[model samples]
Target chain A: MSDSPIDDLIQTMGLMWSADGGPRIAGQILGYLLIEGEPRTLAQMCEALQISKGSASTNARLLEAKGVVRRVHPVGSRQDGFLAVPNPSHSLLKSVAKRLRVQADEISDISARFPDERADAQRRIADFAEFYRQSADFMDEWTARIGPARGETAQES
Target chain B: MSDSPIDDLIQTMGLMWSADGGPRIAGQILGYLLIEGEPRTLAQMCEALQISKGSASTNARLLEAKGVVRRVHPVGSRQDGFLAVPNPSHSLLKSVAKRLRVQADEISDISARFPDERADAQRRIADFAEFYRQSADFMDEWTARIGPARGETAQES
Candidate 1:
């Protein structure tokens, strides 16, 4: 109902990230930092987003851990600030690929324990494992290709 | 810990699917059906898995919707039996790719609404959109390559 474009965009990203298994608040925090394009203290984030200080802090830490956000400390200042990591697309893909690799390894190990009579089931599981492994490899290649752009952004910062 | 290998495998699959955003019970059901390699009635699944009838039914329906399970009716029987679909790896990958495509489209649309002054944010969003779009295309190509094997499995059934 609110006709604010920025607010709508933030809410949309929040929903998307929530669907991706992260907290909606973390997505909102990332959205805010991306659009604001500046380091913001926890207090400023809470004030601007009309969220509780605890919520802001918790989500900020979560996003930071996920490599989508980073902590910043201004010179001569005791308070910490947060900023969205530039070009987080590669990190996000890598995280997903890492999880898929874990799944693949787990399934492969499980299939190895199957009895000879269950060879069919074992083969099926192996196929699934192979699919995940290949997918992870593809993602790794993509991450490498994007590495240069990410490095350039880091240098600019 | 139970020394039952099959139980351990199903539990592991449940954990993986839970992480992938599906219900754990659905993953367990898929695991069970994959190993069992035969059509099973809802009652049989409930009794074998020691799960309640409600849980079995709900999870079975969920798996079926995800293309991981299929319901078959035995000739002259009123009850429906479920079997793990052949080559679910392709379906699973396709499902993930479809979801990513949807996310890419959503983010692309959001980026289009950004004001001209927010070009930096717009460009970042565009890059994220492209990454997801490309990932989806890669998955699509993989799925197509596996189509023949999937068809052979279907013919065997």
Candidate 2:
């Protein structure tokens, strides 16, 4: 166990993200970027986090795709760098809300195929679908109040 | 792929929950209980889900611990059974909210230890902590409006 506070934060994030089925290294990179508050080269990340170059590069791209981080061209550096986006938790929450909506759709689709005799199952399925749908809506409202996600315009279409 | 609707639902839940770092079998069992709408013996679960008795027993216990299901004594049956609680998704959401709160706490604790030289990191850490805290609060309010979780009283102290 490291006595460093930054290490503790990195490990906390790594564990949390891994628990959500995300790569632990991605969370660690996010943590590193969060505290460093600057764009970091892939090599710098590998050196600081003690991770392989390939792992750092892959997870950095993953985080970029998730909108939790953005790629940057660091001055006087050959390699591109990654920086944590402002309010990254919102981006992560937005992805979760999207999944909840998908789950709702899947339940609704399956529920439509039930036989007439399976009334109980139909009712239960409807309830489950509604819960997920409403949860997604709630999340949308919450994230909206927090402001637009990275690269998103505040103006409603 | 199976053309059965329940099978589709089960697979969907299995994938979703497993993606959230839960046991796939547990999600399958939850889906089974959701559509079945009744208590199921471990033997019946093993037979219908085609899972090993050990897997059925373990996952059932895990679900019960998560408050998504409850153990019950089946009439005229020596073996105990498990039943899905009403609105099990609420329980799952509640658990997620609790985790968000924990993350907020961890971030806050680490932020307090930052030195005067780390003003930028402190500001960013504060934003991250606030997002998690508010998100958790939003989830709690939403779940409360939806009604009490299984075994929870509606009355607030």
- List-wise, what DockQ does each model earn? 0.49, 0.71
- True contacts reproduced, candidate 2: 0.80
Model 2 quality (TM-score): 0.91
Encode model 2's per-residue lDDT on B1-157: one tens digit a residue. Answer: 6778888888888887897788999999989999898888899888988999999999988888777887888778899978888776667668878888988898889888887898789889888899888888989988778776665322211
Off by over 4 Å in 1: A148-157, B116-119, B148-157
Let me know the DockQ for model 2.
0.71
C-alpha lDDT (0 to 100) for residue A108 of candidate 2: 92
Candidate 1 at residue A117, lDDT?
Answer: 86
A99-127 per-residue lDDT for model 2 (tens digits): 88988898898888888898789898888
What is candidate 1's lDDT per residue for A23-137, written digit by digit as tens? 8888888888877878889998888788999999999988776677878889998889898877676667777788889899998998899889889888877877787888788
Query: First chain TM-score in every candidate?
Result: 0.90, 0.90
True contacts kept of each: 0.42, 0.80
